[model samples]
Target: MGRLATLAALHGVATVHSPGPDVAVPVPDETVVAVLAALGVDASTDEAVQDALTRAESAAASRLLPPTVVVWTTPDPGTSGAVLPPALPRALADLPPGTGLRVETERGDTVEWPSLDAPPTDAAAPGPVSAAPEGRSWPDLPLGVHRLAAVAADGRTAGAVLVVAPREVPQPPPRTHGFLVQLYSLLSTRSWGMGDLGDLAELATWSGRELGAGFVQINPLHAAVPGDPTDPSPYRPSSRRFPDPVHLRVEAVPEYAYVTGQGIALLDGLLERAAGLRAAVLDKGALIDRDAVWQLKREALEIVREVPLGPGRRAAYHHFLAEQGQALEDHATWCALAEVHGSEWRAWPSGLRDPRSAETGRARHELIDRVDFHSWLAWLTDEQLAAAGRAARDAGMAVGIVHDLAVGVHPDGADAWAQRDAFAEGMSVGAPPDAFNANGQDWGLPPWRPDVLAASGFAPYRGLLRGLLTHAGALRIDHVMGLFRLWWVPAGADPTRGTYVRYDAEAMLAVLVLEAYRAGAVVIGEDLGTVEPGVREELHRRGVLGTSVLWFERDWEGTGRPLAPESWREDCVATATTHDLPSTAARLTGEHVELRHRLGLLGRPLAEEQREESAEVADWLGTLTRLGLLPADGGDEEEQIRAVYRFLLRTPARMVGVWLPDAVGDRRPQNLPGTWDQYPNWRLPVADAEGRPMTLEELAASPRLHGLMSVLRPSVVN
Candidate 1:
């Protein structure tokens, strides 16, 4: 057991800390063994454990540095463009004197110290580190990823990727308020069954110009895994690298006007069908059918693809293809193959499962045309996303469009199949047992292997950030704590048996900050829920804004009372509700409890659940009444909703987000966490208090919405 423990520690696998503090229950030996196996270490038996431990220690001794080294440049004060000399990083400092070194900087410069006399000081910089130097003080190497080669005294040599980044991410210009919404739930009259990029553009334009919004934060639009019944949750997507084509507005395509003969007839037919599909959800109360909508759009797109691109358009397409490179090819190939085999790539033939295998290469040649079609879809989505961002900025938005980045990718999706080496096999990402659920949770998404990530200098992760930030003003990371650690559950095992696995948070943050920096984008960390104590502080120090939902912002350590607006953290986005929770109306009227009870999702007696929920609401209402945001009479139900936004304004938070559904007195949550088909998880359109879906035009003209927006002044202290 001791030998196994040492082996696990060397691999950064947690054998404890699941189910949390004060609990003496240790992680099972089997769980530790399974996690080790996933990391390519074998500790199945006592003899195996000792053997693995010996090999691990031997590797540690021989290794000069981790696969990656990150450094933050320290600028000297009271000097003209001067930087302090960097002290020896712990990794370099530990080596014997007279070691040889070579550095190839990003700016095509080189620095070599043959039989080093001195290039490093004895002191090291303090920050998130993996044997990082005490203080980053390299005057010669500018900010970028560089290469380093080291030769030890005894003739051993090692090479590592060196990263130089800024100390913090870009900060918001000033305090600003924005609308938070799930893009698909917001439908305009022109949309075909679900919201499209066109709808997003109009929403941003209207909100930025008329409603005085500074940003429009929307749910992730990452490409979905295609199947008969595609998963509707945007959080679980096929590839975070590409936007989903389902959200594209067909008519917006320039080639739509160029279509002739049979193509024009087919498009018209699809358009009429699309109108019927949209009417079903808005006028007939039917849930949003993502698969059906995709089918119609896919058919229409096939016809549009026949039209030849203009000279200028052709050039732009080639530019996009060149920039996207191999990543686009892999994603498109997966999509084309999925059309033949299925969405789940693991179920495909063994030869085809390996993306780089010779068989897969042969298959790619045969499916060349289909692959090109899918690649075109990605390009179209990219074009619309850029248009949406431009619309927001043109309408005089301050922060413009804010895009969400989900924590992980679907287990059997494009990213997992294409980048299998970077992801753990037979291990799924999840949460340890907490107050919410004793059994914990398995999200069914594969976690990126930290070993692979460091070895490659987090190249894949950096690429993902750049893609998302390309058209975003700000990027919000879902479950930002994941930058530090994630719970790993073995396949087919209970989530409760999972244990936490640590990542080099220093390297992760350096890559994130560097990429976002290059894009000139703000960063928001979704650090809600029971967070590890120092995680939020570290993020804040890096200029990453945290998410502060109203319901969860309490003085937990003290009286457990609602945290006063004045007391709220300034470096956060404050809001009354989010997609995962009840709308303002539902909380005020206790309709959420009723909805859950009706769906048989209640875990307790009806009266007991209602009483607990009611008490919680009463406490918050009392706080609001005292703050003068709520009137003593509280006459109209919608007035209470308006009052909630007013309260959010009182907080000194730099960014304020109003959940778009709450603007119209919506009574239902866009998502109900625990329920799947029993409740429509992500299908409902934005609706009014009576549960009637409202179109974008109606919503814009809604009296309830206007009244809510009126309370959202630029800076309302009181």
Candidate 2:
């Protein structure tokens, strides 16, 4: 089909092309179809032409949709730029009345000012700009503090203004200190081979009271996608909204003790297995067996559910049900669907694919009881998490418990199934090419569509924050830059082909601050990697703390030496290492590189890279020695750890995180990225440098661990 004819046909427009006329006349679809029949072309049989036209029209329409508005505010004459307030609302509304706006361009220093009313045709098309309403004062405006303004009719201020500032909502107070820890499935005594809520509470209480730790930051406890052998990594979760019930301490339930005759006997073996699992980790130094623990607990919980919930407990359950309501239903529906549809909803029956379809509705009703059970599990998990937080508070921890928010949820999981509209289909969230991973990594998680998110007022994001912040004194946002933009790898494309899609950072941050402020929780952004310039500045401006990892700290512009503690950014939570990284002992001893090479997963040969990397580390150690920070030779591991903390103490960072593994001199990292089955990702227990398991009790008394804390005690203690 001809271009004009195809475009017209696709758009449902009729086109008339006369031999004598150069111009083609466009007519409506009805008219064209009737005329085509009269001409005997049988346009109804022209499906190819019709499809082409449809696509062409769609492309054209997309181009015509409103462009994003980019407002630029001129700096006050003498100043380089306006020193906007931390907040933006108040300043945007106070522009003087009857202000005339103009766009300026420079042609070799001769400035050309284009009229706002009659914008240049060749110039960038003018986007829709809403003028300031009459009689609104800048201070009284709801835009907060920092806002853009221009000179008006009296040369004071006029034209469009862009507001760049912190959210109006109050920010959560900083977490003064924290002891970062990870719970292994095999470590807790009461767990069915998995660390349970009871253990979490116990650990929090002990760490808070005896160790004088202000906060306890745990790994992500998000529910995993259910399967025979579930994915062990907590970072890859099914749902960020709900906690996994597998972490529940079965014996801790009030009704467990009240089980009748046969039930009690049946539960005995499960209880024994639970105790044995805990012993294995605490005594035997074995890695946590998550699948085995789940098997034991699932059996135990099935029996426990038979012991009827008492009236008061049932009422409390109902209250939780009420609080969770739709979200619970959706999550449970997702779980049930996964069981029937096999995880990925895309491969499911056509009728059952859309979550809102009648097939899904009927299935939801049919599986109502199953859904209730899942919801109950979530409630139990929440109760335990709250109890852990309370234990920290009761034990007198300053900042109490801090929770980790994973970067994203699994694509075929609850959040994706529940809020599909908010997520971008056929796109995966990933990282761009970086020094560590030459080939960028695709996380296989769907990203939130910026347009959809803003239109919904970020309700899904807000809800998640509120839920997580409920029992947390501080929240660590994994890959916090996701709030601003996400790297979107289109389906079937490599990570390199991915582009950065922008998000309403201001809106997202505002919502986050609002929820965190109300929950009285501090926010920490894991702003690591190839961050866009000014993102950290924006986060700092918003009272959000940045993450400072010791290994990554460097003099970016100078000779590449490890950044000095005094020169480190103050607006951050400084840490020796994270869950995904090598533990301090492992790094100091060079075990991590060796482990990678042994698995045949190292990008380069182990010995060669080790030599180069070790030399850098040796140089860093020399620098530390020169600065009087490193201890003299022949010191034990404990002394070495103390030296590391002493260096961290020198930084002006508001908070310092003492990794639990580091305290115990654990030689292995809890997780090693880029290697899945080759190594256990999240199943390792807290062990000593020699791979000897350490119980909470032993950890408390270990002089090596204790000495390290002693160094940090004065710096973190209130």
Candidate 3:
């Protein structure tokens, strides 16, 4: 290998990739240097490259252990049911034969494995890792993150984070179907202009019990960046770790009932305004105004804060305060500071930018009341989420509320500010150039540094998982491929100048599996679009279900025809549409093309785009007609939409998701990719085929939705 190639390989940065079959793209030298720089390696100058290369070459020899190690115990084939021992990974095994090994387990128990017998650990992250011992090498260890230290015969010492995880994640209970709704767009009469937690709970209860649905998956409700006009996209969240307070239903808070005297008059006025906001959207045909909704809710929340908490509520609040610990404090502090300084932490006074600096400490204390208010908002939202889950359970749903986890956090969000050390400074996660877009794409969210995560024992990742799974029946990871690797683009550079940086997929999956196992929640990975070879298989092997959109599930290796229902993978959340794509109704009628054309997002002539889109839709419809899933005589838009979902039910997929809007014959895509101000992306309320907004109650009573649900599995009633 070349010097730069060797350095890049050692750092888990890809030097070459095949964006297409038999075509290799060698990463640019500048890209490699920039990526290495982001990882804290100085390789700008030739002399610096040589020096860095020399250090990297000797890193394995000088290192006693990697920052982290994994002990994935498998069942012994020879012994039938016995589990194989957790061997010392290749790195530890390759140590001097007489080295002593000590482990401190998560439970605080200590174990001293005989140094002579333990298998080696991952080989110091040198060139590549080898397979672990599957035979009778060591004793079976508990599944948890532990601490391991090694001392060699010559007094050399090293320590590593030891992670023991289940071989797979929790599996789904059985075949079931659910609805996938973008939370903001599913407004109800009671909603304050847009969908709130109250609407979510009502939808869950009605669908789960009345429709016999097993789950209801919603888009990310992660804390959004506070701005005069906030970014409407939930995927670009400020903090994926905390739920956004704007989703909270003000009237549902227990304390909302206790306001007395003049407080009642003020709250009544706020409620009247909130009703006007809701009416403007549902009756006046105005777009959902998230900022206005939040303003009203925020004002009412400030009023509600005056009521003193009872003893039980106070204790519960204290428990939540203590459980969240410093993470909550940092997030609340950042929010408090944002109110004073501005939303961008980077532009704040230098010392204040450092979350742990003395200046930030004093500021936190001075603004303790505001900090407490933000923290309280988080607590209230969390409580409502838990209540929603309870409502689902009460409705006899098997998989209650399935939640989505966004790929990463916004750079200026609380997570990036609070956990600054764990993210790359000048790098953003994106995709490399491909057939879809020659320019490639840059998602302005910062990725977590694999090196920092390993050294910190993946504390931040674990905390994130725990928070999300606290009330989720299942967790759908958006852009699941990010668990394995991410395309990192340097600031001010085209995405074509980016390269894929590998993460420790094994460790990442292990942590994920461990957390899901603890929560007893199934995981569904969004593995749509171009996937790297073997990634889907690996995710499946770990019991992480893949996403299969009907439009894209063709027999690519053979005839390139729509895949037969029987041939679809059983472990997936099968669906006809997603929030990013055209709704089934739109796809069937070709309105999606017209919508794109209207926004000037079409790359070709209008007629050409329409022709291609219509052909694709006709191809799917023809397949459906051939298989007798759809009427041989052309059916209407509603029948075609039903047939699309009916085809999903034919597949052995464990869970099928029905986009909520499709149930009511909605043609507008919740989000149209590749457009900004030109389109009303993520701002429209769920409406009917006629383009009229529908309240949650109206949606529930829609005969069209009932007719469509009848086409689903027999579990759901007509």
Which candidate ranks first by lDDT, i.e. highest?
3
lDDT of 3 by residue, 1-718 (tens): 7888888888999989888999999999999898898898888887898899899878767788888887666534343122544454676567776777777777666766546545433221211122346332454556778888888888888899888777887787679888999988988888999998999899989988788889999999999999889999999998999999999999999999999999899999999999999898888989888899899999999999999999999999999999999999999999999999988899999999999999999999999999999999999999999999999989888888999999999999899999999999999999987878878899998989889999989999999999999999999999999999999999999888899999999889989988887787999999976689999999989999999999989999999888999999999999998999988888888889898888888899999998988888888999999989899986988888888988998899999999999998888988888888877889998989989999999999998998899877554556
Q: Write the per-residue lDDT of candidate 2 for residues 131-217, one digit (tens) a residue.
A: 333322112112211222244555553322222222432333343556888765325434566667787788788877776777888
Query: What TM-scores do the predictions have?
Result: 0.94, 0.78, 0.95
Give the 10-residue window scoring lowest on summed lDDT in candidate 1: 122-131
Q: Quick one: how many clashes does candidate 3 have? A: 8
lDDT at residue 510 of model 2 (Cα atoms): 69
Q: Could you tell me how far off, in angstroms, the CA of residue 285 lies in candidate 3 after the best superposition?
A: 1.5
In model 3, what lDDT does residue 207 have? 89
lDDT of 1 by residue, 377-408 (tens): 99999999999999999998888999999999
Write down the TM-score for model 1.
Answer: 0.94
- Local distance difference test values of all predictions, in order: 0.86, 0.69, 0.87
lDDT of 1: 0.86
Question: Where in model 2 is the C-alpha error above 4 Å?
Answer: 1-175, 279-286, 714-718
Pitting candidate 1 against candidate 3, the one with the higher lDDT is 3
- Residue 697, candidate 1: Cα error in Å is 0.9
lDDT of 1 at 281: 96
